[model samples]
Target: MTTDRADDRNVAVVTPWYPNPQQEWAGAFVQAMVEATAPGCDEVTVYHNEAWLMRQAPEEVEAAREAHRRLLPVALHDAPTVAGARLMRLPVPTVPDYTFAELAQQHASWLRESLGGEPIPARVVHAHVGLRGGWTALENARPDARVFVTEHASFIDKVLEQPDSRDMYEQVLDRCTGFFAVTDVLRDRLAETFPALAHKIELISNPISFEAPRPRPVTELRRWLYVGTLVERKGVGWLLEAFAECHAGDPELTLTIAGPGVLAGALAKRAAELHVDHVVTFTGEVAPDEATRLMREHDLLVHPARWETFGVSIIEAVAAGMPVLVTRCGGPERTLAGIEDAVGEMIDVEENSESIVAGYHRLRDRFPDGLDLAKGRRVLDERFGYRTVAQAHYRHWFSGPEAGEGAASGGEEA
Candidate 1:
């Protein structure tokens, strides 16, 4: 299952977020994108830039450096094989003296140096997010190389919040050979923010790595699920209030919040104060299989992110034929675009508590009744499945050097 062509499709994928033993689901989507790319190329090598001390606990930081001072590169070449790709994990020791761009350059150069100081002669360097990885790829790009950047990071939401950040981000974006956005709305937002590159910004949805699992029957007690890090922007507190609203009317309702984060204890305590703690369960970060099982068993998924570029979890839920209630906080609204009939209504973040409560009630009313979750899944596959996303990347990968660019979608449906 290897390519017959000479290794022309060789690509170097560099990213800040990548799955490691310590962080299993940190950049699972980026890995899925790489896997989707595997079959087409001669060989795809991934360089995960894990900046040490950059985000580590203070105590763990000193201990980690003492233990792994060598910081050597290792080949983790198999197991989760992607037809034609090789996995290389490099653990980097962070130097606080470097700025984001400087650190990123060091990361990319280190990878290039690892290959015996040979300038990587890959077709392109694809960086998963815009933060530093995208800028790094641009800086390290060979004179003739094509550099593709995908800005699916939610930081863009925050970037837009501040004047200086927006300028700094766009300065990095200007260097990309091409830019990919996770949703059409996001593409539009990027274009609106930086009209100069609007034509080059293209719509590229996040790929769903898993197939639709066989869904379970709707439980008699009506199980509700929420899968993601429980953080402030996730609107877990708002969800607790809304959940209590629903439960006050129907004692049979149960809400299970999965995934762990800084907000877990607080959310649980809030749930207790709301008197729904008896019914609410907080199961800290389960494995993927357990997550899929939970998605299958539950009838509804409540996702109320204050901001999101795109919600891959919604795609997973739709695959399991589970209904979801989301907020139009950002990009998740795009998930509802073509599948509104099946997905029903999405809540407006500006809405009051009663309105949020009402949206949940509305989603429950439509669940399993007239809702064909499979129809939503069909729409998801057509738009966000691996094949669709990979093909989009393939086109970008092979685009002639003269194709030039604008911040744009390739005029394809997002």
Candidate 2:
């Protein structure tokens, strides 16, 4: 199962988003994966999708500039220190109202010039997300070059909203040599959509590097921390309502929401309307280190997401020795299942005021002592640590059958 001179093998990690100083969660996983695979890899090149060039909005331009500034330090950090890891910034603007075929053509051209013309050939292309990066990876790799795709979320829901990307999902699947899903729920859905590619789909959870355990005692005034984008899909509005209800009886209860998104203004208004604005504090988009620091101050981590590919936040919380309250719609539920202390009591995804209130009450009654941070941290170290998860991925993507179990193969149409 071991490849001789593994450090000599080259891999190109492709993604649309990467973390900058502002702490974007784009290629964070890819960065973690490369570090884990370093022992068995010679070099890892990160190719980012610079589709922001297509954005003409003044606001988007400002955001892009900020993102670039934040990313510059990490980009430079990766350049020299990390062995076998390189960052390649490719700015490929989206075509104006262009179809996937047209977008693919533009991406292919970018790859031909940026990657295809490189002095050294890449043995494998690993893409995060399904459509754009995956399409570009397939186009850039040699015919027999290994292509691995990790489905982080449901792009079909996002892209198929437009008529042009109607068949984009299938096209991307057809080109991938193997597909990786963050949750079994997503894998099953993908299997149904493209049965022909079902066999190639493998369920893999997000890898989290375990942090130092921080154990806090359960107290009367429970501190609940919600970290993620303050958007509708994250169920922040409902969470606020529930918190208001909880605060009515227990005024000591406080909810700290970290992260920024389009719905920030609405969420703030909703908190005021619910009269819980005093109890809820918004610390817009903190860095990972700061987020972890905030997590340490809280007793519980509540993730009321409507949909998620994998809840890296949950894993991060568990690693920090915190209990989680996640909705049953996405990847976090599965990660919770692996931990005995956090199983069976997931929040309902319906995520209305009633459901949120009910979930809060249920948790309050069940674990008044708060979740067992030690047990949760143990679970994270055993199942989702970056080293173990990355090794699993390396076996699945690079070494073939001899590495271990081969991911399911073949495609099934939905």
lDDT at residue 43 of model 1 (Cα atoms): 71
Each prediction's total of clashing residue pairs, residues at least 3 apart in sequence or on different chains, is 12, 22
In TM-score terms, which candidate is top? 1
TM-score, cand. 1 vs. native: 0.83
lDDT of all the models against the reference? 0.73, 0.69
Question: Which residue segments of model 2 deviate by more than 4 Å?
Answer: 1-8, 53-84, 95-104, 116-120, 160-168, 215-221, 338-344, 368-371, 401-414
Q: Candidate 1: how many backbone clashes?
A: 12
Q: Candidate 1's residue-wise lDDT over 102-187, tens digit each?
A: 55555666555555556556757888776567766666666666788887877666556665556656876787888898987678
Q: lDDT: which candidate is best? A: 1
Error of 2 at 117 (Å): 3.9
